[model samples]
Target: MNIVVPVWGDAYLDTFLEYSLPAQLAAGNVPALEGSGHCYTIYTTAEGRRRCEEHVAVRQLTRFVAVTFKSLEVVATYNAGNKYRTKSDCYAIELEAASRSGAAVAMLNADILLADGFIREALRLLRLGKRVIEVTGGRGLQDPIKTALDSEFREYNRIISISPSELSRLWLANLHPQLAMHYVDGPEGGSFHPSHLYWLAGEEGVIIRAFHLYPIVVKPNASPVKFSGTIDDDLVALLAAAPDERLIAQNSSDLFCCELSPPEHFVGDVAWRGNRKSIIDFYLGYRTENIENLEKEIIISSKPPVGELWDRTRRDSSDFIDTLISDLKSELLRRCAAREADDLMAKAAAEIEDDGDFIKAIGQMLENGHPIPLALEERSLRIHLKTYPDRADLLQRLCAVLGAQGKVVPLELEERALKAIVELHPDRRDLLERLRLVQVGLGKTAPPAALVSPSGEEASQTEVDFQQDAEEFGRAVNYRDMEPEFAPILELARRFTMTSVERMYALYKAVQYIEATQVPGAIVECGVWRGGSIMVALAALRALGNTERDIYLFDTFEGLPRPDDDKDIDVLGNRAINGWLPHARGNERSNWAYASIDDVRSNIGLIDYPSDRIHLIQGMVENTLPAGAPETIALCRLDTDWYASTQHEMVHLYPRLSVGGVLIIDDYGHFQGARQAVDEYLAKTGTPLLLNRIDYSGRIGVKVQKSSVGWLQKLGWR
Candidate 1:
């Protein structure tokens, strides 16, 4: 006997190879049949063939049986789009292949598990002069039970013996109690379809009567009719059997087979409609001239058990519909309650003026799964922090709620809250750990030693005052308003850059700083990936009517230069520095980081910025900064991520940065190397500069007065 299987898709193939095939092999039907001259053929796609071969090698399936694989050529019309067409094509091909073998063939679906001794029982009937054998033991196993059975089989390396009672228990658990009761008492019992026969294992072995019989095993040359996807399987069985040959329907009590329910073995009204079309097509195709005879045959078949099953089905369906209606009503009531609760929360939030009460209202909304506008929650939290700076408990609760909702809280507020919590509770190692994470998320390497007391002492009053002052500065710098003219440019720039709107607003602020201070110099950007940031600066410059200032855009214009592994490690301990290509798998140009110089020029052209004033210097910053960079810079933006690049840019450009010029460090908080380079350069210069936090990963600092001496003393007249 040759066992022919047709399977497709990764999911079905995985289940078939992992569970179905293993069950058959364990049942002594696969390798055990080699002595009886049994072979196996699997028909699948090219990719599926690769998977099957891999499985065969890993499981050594060929060592047991002479297994052969055939790749079914995928036809665009038949095997590509429609699943039904694919199934039909596979069956047609497998049947054709089986016919050529000149041996008894058992055609089976890939997504089914055969019972122990099923093949032997089929062969016994064949030896007893049965030309075509229909094995009636098709049971429907729900997904969860199928998963459990697969797990058990894999763990034990054999099919675990499940008694008929246990099988029935598993089947009933997946069904509603009312539905299960009806099914158990119905004419079909546990079978997949109403017209199908069902049998259970008992002391008498297995006893089954024919019910919409399917030809499980066929003798050589007996299958004259070709099978198709458009024709039902049972109809194919009926047509395949020769008029002179004997046909028998039987099942061994020791043998059983089950298909996974819901999907693999579909049930209910939709499945019936689909199957009915194919059955009707088969009958029409069987004898086109005998329409009357076909109708008579259908009427004859619809007598007795099917008629009884139909009446039972109607009654069961009525009960199921009533239960469904009750469930729907309960669902509607639950939704109404949820909506009322949401309205109450919104009303409370709108009425509440106190910052503390407002925070509580927002938190409650989040806890109850009510949607709260991100801007509203953010503004409320910021206001609460201003009024009650030491309320780490409320802050933590709000932050946790925001995190759970996947809402991104401003990193500044998160850092401030975590610092207060850590300082107030020095013994809280968990809080300290959380503080480190927040710091890393801000693009900083680690929390400074001074932030955490070594002796576990509570934060002093001065420390609290400093935190309050920092919070005040953050509020002062928050760019809440978008200038009307810059809005369109910002929108256009978004297409070229991944920088947040907040960061872009900060850039606009930098332009405002230069305008107010009358700082005279060009705008210099060290790492211009796609020229988005430079475009923002150009827009701001244009808005301020400072079109005369030359903007020097410096970059490799390929991607990021390779980082120094020892000095450029991230907080997560990843040495690969390109954020665009975190794993550093392929060439730098492969990802978003690699924008061409021509593309940047084209993007600038889109905004109609002064072409000559914009200097698109293309090369590594280390090499280009020495020759291509501007001599004097008023607004310098350093986005270079590596330690060496950042350090070099600071060494060459810091001196050229005029007094009161704004220096924006884009990767200062996110990249440890970038932060370290900025800190080291600032420390060497001994400049009294205040690096204000802009966003999570950006910092803006104005190069202020270098002298520590008083104005009068510096005059030398005193």
Candidate 2:
């Protein structure tokens, strides 16, 4: 019997000799391949061939004929374009060498160490005319002495061996070929063999008889070797075509041929290492019944070190913590119960403090503009408050973080933090105003009556008083340096018009939708007021290095066109409203009524992005969007405040909006005309798009499955 082991590199040579070779020699079937005067070939890369040569000489394996080669380029010419050319090239050469010896050949991977008596039983079955014998590697079957190269083989046959009779008794055990072990009888000149295919394209071998050593007769859990290419599909194809009568033998003992991790995709129970349950119970109750264990095996037979296992466990646990926290937060958010979320968050925060990596993961998520779950945010706030009771700055930052997600600090915390800040500063009227606003938001009290003046001139100071009275205190949560994602855009917006938080959120969602769907189109921002929000879109694109998508900015670059009676019917109806046309038409400082093309261009230039990607079309949307808009739109932001312009964008851009793209109506909650345009368009087209509100103002709708009304129109259905 000749063992034909194919070794690519010298990395696992030590383990192979200690655990595999000795067992085969102990079986007493025949001489070792080295002593038998049979050619032993090692297929390897140029460097690997050199290393193997040096290793054999240093180890003084004097009898072994170490034949090594760099390239089987000749093999490529034999079977060009074969998917398994890499494997076939080497295997063909090995089998060719074996054919010359006329001795039965045992094919093996150098990474595996054979169990005792493997060679004797294999030879016994081979002499009985078993053409192929496969050995399956299973969990915890390693040769303990094989862990070290110099350890003498303590040949305990009962523990290490699987006899033929014992294997035959446990024939019901399932085995898969991925365990990577097999033996073949030496081919005579007239017989079929896989090596024949090297010269002929269609020739396939036939295995007249096959046997499986099912208790796993080898330990494959040696030090890991990483292979570079994939040829398993080709190998399977070759095997399937070979004719064979397969006989599988399962060893009833605790022995396994190789140490293999149980298959992850296998829903059936296989005994996993480190499991507390007895192996017999696992096999009889679970493995036979095909039940899945939640704690599936994680170890691979590469025999990774103890330190590596610890590191892997730590990393996996950290990921599980992140997922668990996220799930808990989502449930709390849906319930809108702050107390429930806080309880879980507080526990998690304390537990994660032991893991610096987990803490950094949470921080990284927040820095990436991930909204902090309300529970987590509240728990963090409480921790910080306890650490620094007088830290108003920290409290304010926490408040801003929560406020971005439309959450407020608990009423008591809000009162305490505001009072401390106001007492310390004594002149921050803004803080006083915020405190009063928080009170009103919490529904704690009716607003105090307006203060009257002594001069009987109806001198109620409430209208002039920004601290005590205002419709809305904060138009947008102050991100400042906290959210780098939107900070620069907000700073740019402040230079022209007051960009609402709601509007910024809508633009944020625009970038998200484009990226998520990978929608292939440019962004079209209609009614670019002072280029603030448009700059937001451009900044996001530039940050992502997305120069492929173009920006189409359509606006009058001036105040809204005077309401024509036919078109401005909706606009005229809101004329008497205080925040309607009058406020929108103002041309004074920072008013969004007038947006000059030059001003928008100048603002956009301040951002460090390629100017060529932005195409600013200065005209009313009604005049420009009819022809100037991009044919495909990922996002269409409508800031046009009047009915006419709104109607124009809805007609021009909506139909062309990419499927799964977003359309953000910036003034949906603020302007009746914007809402009217959106509602009317959906109604006419019978498009079933739900309007989801982003904040107090902006509303967005993702284009769903496209309406077939246009196709129906072509057929004259309407």
Per residue, candidate 1 scores C-alpha lDDT tens digits across 1-718 of: 7787777788778777766776667545664564746778787788888888877432555767788776655422222233444454555555555567656777777776665566766666677766665544345554776766756434454444343334434443443222221121333323222233122222212222232344566664634445422223333443445544534332223444555445343232101222332223222222222222111111111112234444454444445434533544465567569658866777778788887778788777755655454345556756866777778755875665464334666787788778877777788655676677667778886533333332325544234555544544444444445667767877767656656677888998788888778786778898887788888888877777766566788886666766776777765455654443331323323222556676688878765665645666665665455545555678999997889889989998888887778999998877889999989987776555678988778999887655632442365422
Which candidate number has the best TM-score?
1
Candidate 2 stretches greater than 4 Å from native: 1-435, 438-484, 564-592, 707-718
lDDT of 2 by residue, 1-718 (tens): 4444544434445444444444434333223232444334444456655665565332333344344343544443121222223443455444444445445445555554454456556656655655444433332213322332223334443112323223222221322222211112222222221110111001111111111122111111122212211222122222221224222333323222443222331212122222222222222211111111111222212122245444554355345434533543464455345435534544555467544444564465344323234445555656667778878756765655554333544776777779777887787666787788678767875765554333434446333544332334232334432456676566655444445655685686579668767875678887776677877777777777765466778776654555433333332244413333332432211122444566678888777765545667655564344445655777888877666678878887888787878888877776566678778887787666767977656788887653554565566543
Once fitted onto the true fold, the runs of candidate 1 whose alpha carbons sit more than 4 angstroms away are 1-480, 577-592, 708-718
**How do the predictions measure up, each by TM-score?**
0.33, 0.33
Q: Hey, what RMSD does candidate 2 come out at?
A: 28.7
* RMSD to true structure for each model, in Å: 26.4, 28.7
